[model samples]
Target chain A: MAERVMAEAVFDDLIHPSTRLSIVALLASADWADFAFVRDRLGLSDSALSKQFATLEDAGYVHIERPVTQHRRRVRVRLTDTGRRAFVGHVAALQEVISTAKLGARSD
Target chain B: MNGQVSESEARLALDAVEARRQQVAAEIDVPGWYWWSVAAGWVVLGALATFAPVWASAVGTVGFGALHAAVAPRVISGRRGSSRLSVRRDLVSRRVPFLVLGFLVAMVALTTAIALVLDADAARHPALLASGIVAALVVTGGPLLMSWVRRRAVRRLSA
Candidate 1:
């Protein structure tokens, strides 16, 4: 009836590219990683890792904890149950993209 | 154990501190262009069929039917660029709904098309309607489903 362009907006609910990569890598490989561990693996600065972790934590994809010793405070991070599920989902989405049979891909 | 009661306790202690850093994801919803692309594809096919039904029918196998079905799963989930589904079990578990949705939509679309072809006054035919409806439904409903599931999962994680 109406002549207009239609597009599927698949990027809406996704985590950022860098953040997602870091997240998936972290969630998929180890059950938990410390702030330092993630920072080292992702090659991110302290503030950068902090920013990313904050985002993930807010979205309920990660569980963040801080333990204080005699005086020093350290952070421990783990993939929440939701985070694990999201990681699984994220992997599936990637599979769909890679499914040439499903995508009519020409240049596989 | 020095600064905190124990490693576990310290870990627990840091929970709220790190969690408070979470911010609302700016790109936490599906995109829009993908919807328009599919719609455009269907409209083009409809136009082609109007001009030469036979030619459209032939190409439609690949372009209209196959191409659309091919990408439906990806679009429906609104996750276009994930890179970790190599593990078979992981892939299958998450895509159960997607595969099921694909089959259901195809069956429904085919049934509707067949009905239109058989009906005398179906007006405009069912091919166009079916394609457009499937695309729109998946684009809208798919994300809603994901959003609902994500919230549920988040709640579970919190517990």
Candidate 2:
């Protein structure tokens, strides 16, 4: 029961925001993706994507790289190990919350 | 942050996770060049096998297989899609290699069966005919087939 409570407490506020959660979820599946790809997929404006990237970067949840390819600069994003851990924990916490709710409803 | 999360919010969050995962799965694709190269290679190899001497054809087959083995790993690693972003290693299904191998085996078997059937019909250049048919399939359906296979693999992994 104590473990259940601790597990429920593992929700990550940093990743709880919908936009940030979406970003982390996408990054969780790939090693790295370009900025344009994420923006296009998420249907976010360049500025909006950049702002989200900055927020995740500040939290050390994502690493951004700007590399020049054939004289063209491109930004790439990837989830950090710490970010992955946080996302996984938050997901587990969410699952726990749902399961606990289901159990409580059944008891009542 | 320590406040209790409501059941509804938790369910919503879980839905978000699934949605994001689906987005990633949808993005799992080999670059366009992969399909095009495969099509070209199929035609080239088919032509070579049709025209070359048996020894030469054997050498070509071995050489092409070796080249594919060497280069295909980099291309099919699911690292990069049409976008500049590289996919994460964990998200990539380990069954990818098997999927590719199975696809190749099926293609080879189809080509061989076509050749045998045409040969039985006394058709001239049965091998060439088989190659043309297989090459056409590769050009037209390779990408779609790859996409379908990747989706299935992702579904299996997620399950």
Best by TM-score: 2
What is the per-residue lDDT of model 2 for residues B38-151, given as tens digits with 9 covering 90 to 100? 666776677777788888888878887888889788777655666666656556676666766677778889999999999999998888888788877766666776688568
CAPRI quality band, candidate 1: incorrect
Query: Candidate 1 residues B32-115, lDDT tens each?
Result: 564456556655654555456686567865766677678665554433212211111221225435644664466456646654
Model 1 segments beyond 4 Å from truth?
Answer: A1-108, B1-3, B6-31, B65-93, B96-121
Over 4 Å off, model 2: A1-9, B77-79, B153-159
- Colliding residue pairs in candidate 2: A30-B87, A30-B88, A31-B87, A31-B88, A32-B86, A33-B85, A34-B85
Model 2: lDDT of residue B104: 70
lDDT of 2 at A44: 95
**DockQ for each of the predicted structures, in order?**
0.03, 0.52
DockQ of 1: 0.03
- Compose the digit string of candidate 1's lDDT tens values, residues A1-108: 010113222221444254555554444434345577567645679998888778888888778778775687777777766666655454334433444333455555
Instruction: Give the lDDT of residue A91 in candidate 1.
Output: 37
Worst 10 contiguous positions by lDDT, candidate 2 chain B: B78-87
Q: Against the true structure, candidate 2 has what lDDT?
A: 0.76
Chain A TM-score for model 1, please?
0.73
